[model samples]
Target: MKVGIAGLGTMGRVHAEAYRRMGANLVAVYDANPDRLAGFAAEFDVEAAASYELLLRQVDVVDVCTPTFTHLEMAETAFALGVDVILEKPLALTVEQGEQIIRAAREAGRRLFVAMVVRFFPQYRRAAELVRAGELGRVSVVRLKRVGFLPAAGWFRDPEKSGGMPVDLMIHDLDYARWLLGEPVSVMARRSPALSGQALEHVQALLAFPGGEMALVEGGWAYPPGYFRTGFDIAGDKGLIEWSSDQPEPLRTLFPKDEPPPALGLPMAGLEEDPYELELRHALAALESGGPFEVTPEDALAALKLALAVRESAASGRVVEVA
Candidate 1:
């Protein structure tokens, strides 16, 4: 399928390349930055849209690759013009804006899929599969740890643009937790800014759900060297599943084998050699499937709500019930 991409920043460039590798034609491209646009056009050998309006006309799906601030407005305009959309994460800066995007898509008879690419990662897919199969019966606990250095620009160091870790990074972990187990009933969290209040440098959160299920999430954009990690330790009645990217074998499961200890399952398959390529394949698969991509718009909103709930809980210093 032909897809148009907006923005030519890091993500936009990666996605454009992903489309090329996946055999999806990059029919149109847009970027307000002249330098970025020219570099992207040179690198991809694709048509440069004279204007955003012109780009949409040549593509069946519009990939919203712009920043968070521009996402809602762009998605609304794209869907209102009658093309399906692939929205980048944190769905929107606010729940109201997210709802409006959803409303616009529904009213226009269009599809909206969020690019929560973690769900496409093989480790996560295996974890979710194990959880669903009851081999890890009734998952009762999840632990996610992610800490890393920030992007050089507005990705984290600018609250006005990035919304700090709660939006830029933590939301991914939060969304994965909710997507894997279920939504939490309440969340308690602490948020702290670094040397400057320009952005948050640390966050700690505890999510509690019905049936005694729980998650402890720790993440930040301040770190030494460099760090980026995900997946969790999942505990259940029949078995325990462990996932970690740093390990050679990212997933291992234990089950009672009627022995002194237990039986261990094989290691998880390697993750996609390239994530952006996997995203392109999944997006096209969804287009062919007629609905329900790996990341649904409703799931995206639910994840954003949890992130905002963390902000609310931290600001108020009280447990915030998810709406």
Candidate 2:
């Protein structure tokens, strides 16, 4: 498949490498930053498109790895040009923009796949499988967290640009939670207060789903420099499954000793496969087979809606109902 990536930042570089590893034809790339774009183009040995339009024209699909605010423009342009899109999550800055992207893709007959990479994480994927198979029978509660050092004075720190920690970071777990527990009916959230100049930001959201399922998703840009950690604990009537990045052996299960251990593959224990690669591979395979994306455009929109609800609740200090 012919692919192009916009934005030469961390995720853009990651996607480019994954495509290279998959032997995809990396046709071209475009970025607003000339120096970064030139360096990336040279490193990947791909053409540097002079404009986003050129990038879309040169590839069968484009990876819209740009910032949240730019997703609509990039994605709509790709759809208008009859190119499929691999959009990085959170799909768009708002639910309306997300719906527009999905609508445009449907009108243009192009596939729109949201790159919710957390779903492809070995541990996360395994956890979902176990939950779906009733191993975690009737999951009642889930706790998810991701905390990392705050970026200094950038679009990431700007709520208007990157949607802050809630939308940018917490959306991963929020989406994962929705995948595990289904759509949430309401959300209540709290944000750390009185931190000036975006020094530190943290948010905790409690989501309520049908059948008494609940998820507590905590995200922060308050960690020390170079520190990052993520993990989740899923609890149900039968038992619990958990994993943490800080753990030496990552995944853990607590259940009766007599029960046979789950048959998770080698990658689950070691994280041998990069989640980004796995995600892109799944997208490409589904595209080729005319199958469905694991994280559909609608699913991405739901996740974005849920994340926005969390933001609304945090800002207003009231529980917000998700429509």
Candidate 3:
């Protein structure tokens, strides 16, 4: 499949590398920053389109890896041009914009694949499978943690642009929690104030589902530089499941001294296959075969809704209903 990347940020670079690793036809890339555009073009050996429209014209699909605020504009443009869209997570800054993106895609008869890569992770996938197989009968409780350093990008520091830790960092587990359990009916949360100049934030959310299942999800950008961690604990009537990145295993992440903290999350330590590549491969195959995507547009919207509720609950110190 021919692919074009719409931004030269960290996530954009990661997607470009994943496409190359999968042997996809990476036609071109675009970025508003001239320096980043030029540098990324040279580094990837791909053409740099002067405008997003020009890049869209050259590929069958455009991967929108830009910031959260730009998602609506970029996705609408892709749909208008009859190109499939692979949008990065936190579908939009607001649920209204997310719904518009979905509406536009449907009207244009184009495929929209939200890049919720957590579902593609081997460990998470296996856990879901085990649950499906009745190994964890009547799962009742879940706890998830994703803590890391502040992202390197300036825009990420602005709550207006990145939606703070809830939408940017915690959305992964929020989505995963929903997938593992079910739709949450309400959410209660608390958060620390953003640190001066650092944009560091932390939040913990409690989600209640209609089936009496409960989840405690925590996310933060308050860790020391180069320190990142994630883990989960799941409990059910029949069994319990647990895993952590802190174990003396192959899943611990380390960053080089010269590199800045990653924009979204840390580059995972070691795995048999990269989850980003797995996600893209599935996207390509599903687009070609007209099969359903694992993470659909509605699923992305629902996740964003939950994350926004978390932010609201934290700010108000009240429980917010997942409407």
| Number of backbone collisions per candidate | 0, 0, 0
Question: CA lDDT, every prediction?
Answer: 0.79, 0.88, 0.88
Q: Candidate 1 on 204-275: residue-level lDDT in tens?
A: 899999778999888777775466666578888877778776777756777778633332244534554576
- Any idea what lDDT model 2 has? 0.88
Candidate 3 lDDT (Cα, whole model)? 0.88
Clashing pairs in 1: none
What would the per-residue lDDT of candidate 3 be over residues 209-311, giving only the tens digit for each residue?
Answer: 9989999999999999899999987787766667687875433223344555333332344356899999999998999899999999999999999999999
Question: Candidate 3, which segments miss by more than 4 Å at Cα?
Answer: 249-271
Ten-residue region with minimum lDDT total, candidate 2: 261-270
Residue 236's lDDT in candidate 2: 85
Q: How do these models rank on TM-score, best leading?
A: 2, 1, 3
